[model samples]
Target: MRIDSHHHFIDYSEAEYPWIDDNHAAIRRSFFPEELKSVLDTHNMDGSVVVQARESLQETKWLIQLADQNDWIKGVVGWVDLCADDIEQQLQELVQLSPKFKGVRHVLQGESDDRFMLREDFRRGISKLAPLGLTYDILIFEKHLPYAIELVKQFPTTAFVIDHIAKPVIKEQSFAKWNEDIRKIAEYPNVCCKVSGMVTEAHWGQWKAADFAPYLEAVYAAFGADRLMFGSDWPVCTLSGTYSEVYQLVDTFIAQLPAEDQSKIMGETCVKFYGL
Candidate 1:
C-alpha cells in the first residue's frame, strides 16, 4: 500500500494552535479529510496517517472519528499528555475509539526544558504505550536529539519514528551537530524517521529541491530505506510550498535506489511500523 506516512488535519484556530503567529496566516483555517483526500488521490497515495496538530484528547477522538469515516486514512498518530498520571488510561480510551489509532506524539520541540523527555512522568507515560500496542512519535528539534536518543534506549521494544528529520536547520545549511545526533539516534534498531517537513526548514519562497540534498544524503546513509518513510507534513509545509512539491522532492530524490528499497521508504516501512 502506497501511504503518506505523516500529515495532519486541523480545525485551525489561533486559540488551539498558539504556534501559528502572523507568518502562518496562510493556514489559519480548518483542514479536514475531504481536502486531504483530493491531494492523496492526485499523488496516487493509497492511504495516509493523519497526525495530531493540537495536543488535545478531543482532537485525538475527532481524528479517530475521521478515520472511522474515511477509509483512506489508514492510521492515526494522535496526541496524548504523555506526562499525565493517567496516561495509560488515556491511551486505552483512545485505542477503544478505533483500530486506526496507531501511535502518539508529544510536541517536544516546543518545550523549553532541554531534557523534557527525560522527565520521569513522561517516560512513565511512554512505558504505558507499548504494553497497549501503540508506538510513540518523536517530534523534536535538532537540539533535542540526544534526549530522543536516550529515550529510545530505555524502551528498546517500543517502536519510535522521528518526525521531520528532527526539524534540522536546513535554511542555514547547518548540519554537523544535527547530523551527529541523527546518526547516533539511528543506531537504535527500534527507531525510524520521516522524510517530512523539509521545505518549511528551507528558504521558504526560494528553496530548490537541491537545498535538501545534504540532509537527505545524511539520513539516507544513517537510516537506510528500511528505517525511513515519506511524509508530506502538509498545510504547514504549504506555508512554504505545495503538497505536490513536497511529494516530488522526496520522490525524485529516491529515484535511483533499488525499486524494492524505494518501495520500503515510500510506504511498506510505514505499514509495518504502525501495523496499518
Candidate 2:
C-alpha cells in the first residue's frame, strides 16, 4: 500500500486549534477530508496517516472518527497529554476504540526555550509509551536534536520518526549547525526521517523541485532509502504548492535513484516504519 505517512487535519466545530489561530494566513479555514481525498486521488495515494495538529484528546478522537468514515485514512498518529498522570490508562482506552490509532505525537516544535524535553515528568511519561506498542513522532527543531538523540539512547526499543526533516528552513539555505546535529541523529538505527515540510521551508512562491533535491539527496545519503520516507505534510505543504506538485517533486527526485531505492523511500519505508 502506498501511504503518505504525515498529514494534518482540523475540525472547527469539534475543537479549537489555538496554534493555527494566531497567524497561519493561508490555512485559517477548515481542512476537511473531502479536500484531502481529492489530493490523495490526484497523487494515486492509497491511504495516509492523519497526524495531530492540536494538543487535545477531542481532536484525537475526532481524527479516529474521520478514519472510520474515510477509507483513505489508513492510520492516525493522534496526540494526548504525554505528561498526564494517566497517560498509560488513556492510551489503553484509545487502542480499544480503533486499531488504526498507530502512534502518538507531542508538538515539541512549539516548546519553550527551557528544558522541556529533559524534564523528569516528560521523560517518565515517554518511557511508558513504548510498552503499550505505541510510537512517538518527534516534531521539533534542530535545537531539540540533543534531547531527541538522548531519548533514542534511553529508549533504544521505542520506534520514533523524525517529522519534517527537523523542520529545516531551506529557503534561507542555512545548514551549518543543523546539518551536524542531523548527522548525529541519523546515527541511531531506531530513528527515521520524514522527507516532508520542505516546500514551506524554501522560497515559498519560487520553490521548485530542484530547490529541494539537495536536501532530499542529503537525507538519502545519510539515512539511505531504507530509513527515509516521503510525506506530503498536506495542508501545510499547501502553503507552498498543491499536493500533486509536492508529490511530483519527490517523484522526480526518486526517479533519478535506482528502482529499489525509489520504492523504499517513496512508500515501502513508511509501511515498515509505521507497521502499516
lDDT per residue as tens, model 1, 65-182:
9999999899999999988888888889889889999999989998889899999999999999889899999999998998899999999999999999999989998899999999
73-120: candidate 2 lDDT, tens digit per residue: 888899988888998899999988898888999888788853576777
CA lDDT of 153 in candidate 2? 79
Worst 10 residues of 2 by lDDT: 13-22
Estimate the lDDT of model 2: 0.83
lDDT of each: 0.92, 0.83
**TM-score: model 2 vs. ground truth:** 0.94
lDDT for model 1 comes to 0.92
User: Least lDDT summed over 10 consecutive residues: which range in candidate 1?
Assistant: 12-21
Q: What's the number of clashes in each of the models?
A: 0, 0
Which ranges in model 2 have alpha carbons more than 4 Å from their true place? 13-15
